[model samples]
Target: MRSSLLRVGVVAGASALVLATMPASLVSASPVTDPPAVDCQSVLAAPTLDAAFDAAAEAADVPSDLLRAVSYMQSRWEGHDGRVSNDGGYGMFNLKSTTTAVPDGAGKGSTDRSPRRTASQLERAAELTGIPASTVRSDDRANVCAAAALTASYAPDLNASTQPQRWTAAIARFGSADTFERQVLTTLREGRARTTSGGETVTLDGDPTVDVAPPSASDPETDCPPDLGCEWIPAGYEKLVPSDPDSTGNYGNHDKADRTGPGGPKLKYIVIHDTETAYDPTIGLVTDPGYLAWNYTIRSSDGHIANHLDPKDVGWHAGNWYVNAHSIGIEHEGWAGSAGWFTEAMYEQSAKLVRHLAHEHDIPLDRAHIIGHDQVPGVTSGATRNVHWDPGPYWDWEHYFDLVQAPIGQSAKNTSSVKAGDVVEVRGGYADNVNTITGCQQASPGSGDCVPGQGTNFVLAYQSPSLEAPLANDPGWKPNGAAGTTYASDISARIQSGHKLVVAEVRDEWLGVWWAGSLVWVHNPATRPVVLRTTAKTVTTTSTTAAPIFGRAYPEPEAYAPYEIPVQSIAPLEYTLGAGQTYAVSDDDVVTDYYYAQSFDGSIPDDRTDVKGELRYYQLWYAHKQVFVKADDVTLLDPGKRAVVPTRLPKITGEAKVGSALTVSNGRWSREVTDFRYTWLVGGRPVAGATGYTFTPRPADAGERVVAVVSVDDPALHPMLAPSLPTAKIQR
Candidate 1:
């Protein structure tokens, strides 16, 4: 819809002889040539450009053959204008802006501009002709004709060169010439010959070299139709049986597989896919006789599996032939961008299927070999510029890898020890499916919203030019949150021990690692041992002094502590700790004290005003201390002032039934459950039990929440209650 001009030119020397026969006024008019009609039915089609070439050659008084030769040189009449030249010129004729002018009638001027600055023959021709510059740059015909006329203008000089070796040298003067002239010339000559002389043609119809065989009973090479061999299985999966008793039949009707062959048993990569349609329809579509077939379809409900094709035959899944032939496609039912999260059962079953397929086919489970549909490269050289992006940003690579037991995280330790500008590999997951949250409110259970103000942090990383290279980022990223607002942060850096990792980028303290091609940061402190640093730093301490803490002063001291404490030697001083001076204590101490002073309750710290709802009861840990502070507190602890504190162990109540709400309370903080995560427990352990307060109960949980008792970390205060008195419980 945009418009621009095109410039055209011709050398003066050859003008005399060629134009002598034509009227002077006619020479200024645009050239005209017969249009080339091409069949567009096949995958490979010849481009149409006769009218454009003829006009330019005729106007320049150059041989049409020469114009054709130049067209062949530029793009082989492929009509692919987006092609980039070595010098950075884009599109057909590689026109430059210096000589091309926007056409008069073209809507906008100069819509098309080459990456290169130098004008080409096509640009000169567009200028000579009246066509707009943008049209010349984008229109195949205008570009071709303009190129021819410019080439013809140079014909005389080339003819006059006495040195036979200089023939190429003279042709090189044309702006449209390629850097590799010999190759260009050869291609031109071949194309000219093919056009002038009838050549063999390729078709997409039934092949002469191969014959389709009927579905046979015992032969493994027979063809099987869809419905006859497909049977539905649980979880929306279909098990496809080979019509031939031997199970060696080829069932695909397309060109993706070899119909006739000594081709080895069909074993290749497994293609992972997510159905854009709903679950039931996905199964119905794949099972229909006329519809497309894949090896398997996994249901999101419970991860039910179905098979529709045999491993020995190809499935019509990947758009690329090479990928289809060498890969087994498995379609998982669900919209990739839908709001719902991929069910745990579905992910588990998918992983099992993938593992089974990998073992059966000897395929390694790595990024290069196991990729999403979005990662499939273009099939042909020309197709590389146009790629499809699917299975989009919603898939969770970290969780998936964990299921597969794949390595993820930085291998080198001592992230802080690593200096700036140094290369390091940092690995972790970027929650692709996470939604952005801008307001303060309780997130629906299992919404996958990385809870803000709850210590969810993401590291910065960049995409590298080489897809295989590690990601990197500029150092120095610090974020601050506003009152009552929860900002989304990356949680990929929460690397723990036993996770898989590959070196991505090496930089001081920061490693850019790949988790599904998306770079995530891994911070390695320099103080830790290198061997211990390389592996994920799993949180080993169940009760961490560093656990975040938050609370507001009671309007009255008696409002919070209903029970009066008896005087004891071990009791801490009862002085109230200000927001800025909240402390952290060792979690391992057996008799550590907490100090709390009865004060005018209304004199709460200004930072305490930022507290909202349940968040007021928790604290954020920093540098190994349970700091009593509000989220909005601006004062930071001095480097040497941090307190060593005991770990805070989480206490869990018993599991509750599905569809029913459960309550979890630890000291002043409590949360109610309403989602799958809230009703389920993994290995009889509450999902968020490690965090000391939140609990996600599952329907099948084996009753009884495991409870642990540990000391709270605080440096400026002593225990208000006995060490064993402050405990949390999970109950329905």
Candidate 2:
């Protein structure tokens, strides 16, 4: 194993605290706190969160406002009924066990560092106040008091007379990373107002007098934004087996390959994942040669990033090798299940990183290109069951995308009704999106027994357009044909906030969408809208029979034969697209090719060769994972190619005279062009040989008014005719 993340703080002299091992839930960006098991949102009636902070501050002789600000920065002062975080943290203070944070002889991704372990804030607070650890976990007042004691311990000589500015070092010592300290200081300067889970508004008027320096520039070695606090904690890339080409077995971590140069695979997606383990443990595992590696990991406590692999290299984080070869993987310091809430710092840093990556690689910042680990498709049929689900129900996709400058439903229509064949985007609030999910304990042991209506980003789809109907379960989720359950890991019937789907039906309060080769309904009450109509390009199957979908977009077998490389099969997945049913497509120009990276050191013949093929595939948002279909299998709907009618009628320009030319213009035609056949009429009757723009009137037509009749032929549309006003009588 490699080194853990936490170590004694050199900046915090004589404190000997492990700043990297700080509690994230203690400093969560969102509201934290688990109400008692019965109700997840209930607040304690007695000794309210505010009163506890006040009492704790007085008891520890720390500045009351400073303590409150610290608590506000850690968690929005909410406590889930004492649920433990992934790192075994509990209550509002995010208290945890410091003894188990660091393993002996651990390094910090480099050999220059020494082994160190510092007692956690909860442990130190327990020693100072003589309060039992169990009491601190359950008792909000005690937890607050313990946290205050630890903060005061950092500055022993300080008293009520000390200013908040003087306590900056003390706050710095309490948390690991300069980024976490800056976030706390930012909160102190600007203040904050949040409605707590207990139905009360807490306001911190904030003191502008408090000076807060901007975050330090990101380390030069890491591939991160300058404003972010980044570190270069590289994941292990050593070979465990000699002559083990193809990386089939016995090797740990990622693969090395170029991704940005000419003829190299283009970067397409950025897969988001959550570390099931805590921050320190995540470091240990990623640095271990026996463990899998990703590109980066964001710390929830402060959004401090650890770049594990280069963006151009391949990481084995996503389950599908095809996705792994073409995308960058980022693991968050959180969990797959409902272990705890994510931090604002984590979301902010992750967004900055993603935006930076997207801009650098020319990847779209939409949800389709920026997907979760759950959205990664399996490499083959019957393989999706083992795929992972992280950044689970609690992750706020709507907000995360907003931070990425690509807000969900930003361009959707808020109509009162929708119909079949309409395309829509699923949109909803995140904080109030409390979806009921059972069996949380089964998903992550000790996380909880039930989520009890926590914030979930997705809406469940049903078998029929009715609330009483069963959920729409996919063939991969239920091969035996059972309906999907409201389990934390079960995303079979779920469609997330930004997923664009084709509407198949509309009941009184339900909207049906074509999901996984079937029509499924999701509730869309007017009071709480879940669907926003959008103008998205959709794909329809042309074949009479169902067209098979594929998990990977590999090239034809003949493409590999030219280079003497082994052929990769273009196998079809179980899902298919039937005629007349349309699915939303993400990309129409998906590359149909494969990269043969056969050896760890490029020793094998024809290794590291990228084979491009003539075949093409279109990527579609089919079911849970994005699947591919042959471009020949479905017709891509192009708005530009559709038949269009002119909004304004055609008109004749210039005065009509016996010898003058009268030109007619196709005015205001949109979406299609107009070609007209013109004829000159005399007294409502056609004049022989007068089809030309300029016609010479003879003496026989001097008293008659002439009219120009235009017959228009729009491309792919029926013909129409318009007549010009009667022209001045031909001059004698």
Which regions of candidate 1 are displaced past 4 Å?
A: 1-262, 288-291, 381-386, 407-426, 430-460, 463-732
Which one is best on TM-score? 2
RMSD of each: 29.5, 15.7
Candidate 2, residues 486-574: lDDT per residue as tens digits? 88899898888788887755678877677887767788887777888776567776644568888888988888877868889888876
Candidate 2 Cα deviation (angstroms), residue 5 = 34
Stretches of model 2 off by over 4 angstroms after superposition:
1-65, 97-146, 159-165, 205-209, 213-217, 242-252, 411-416, 445-448, 639-732
TM-score of 1: 0.29
lDDT tens digits, residues 135-234, model 1?
5555565565555444444343332213322334334543212222333344334343322111222111221322122211222321222211223432
Instruction: Kindly give the stretch of ten consecutive residues in candidate 2 with the minimal lDDT sum.
Output: 1-10
Q: Provide the overall lDDT of each model, using Cα atoms, as 2-decimal numbers.
A: 0.37, 0.69
Error of 2 at 563 (Å): 1.8
For model 1, what is the C-alpha lDDT against the true structure?
0.37
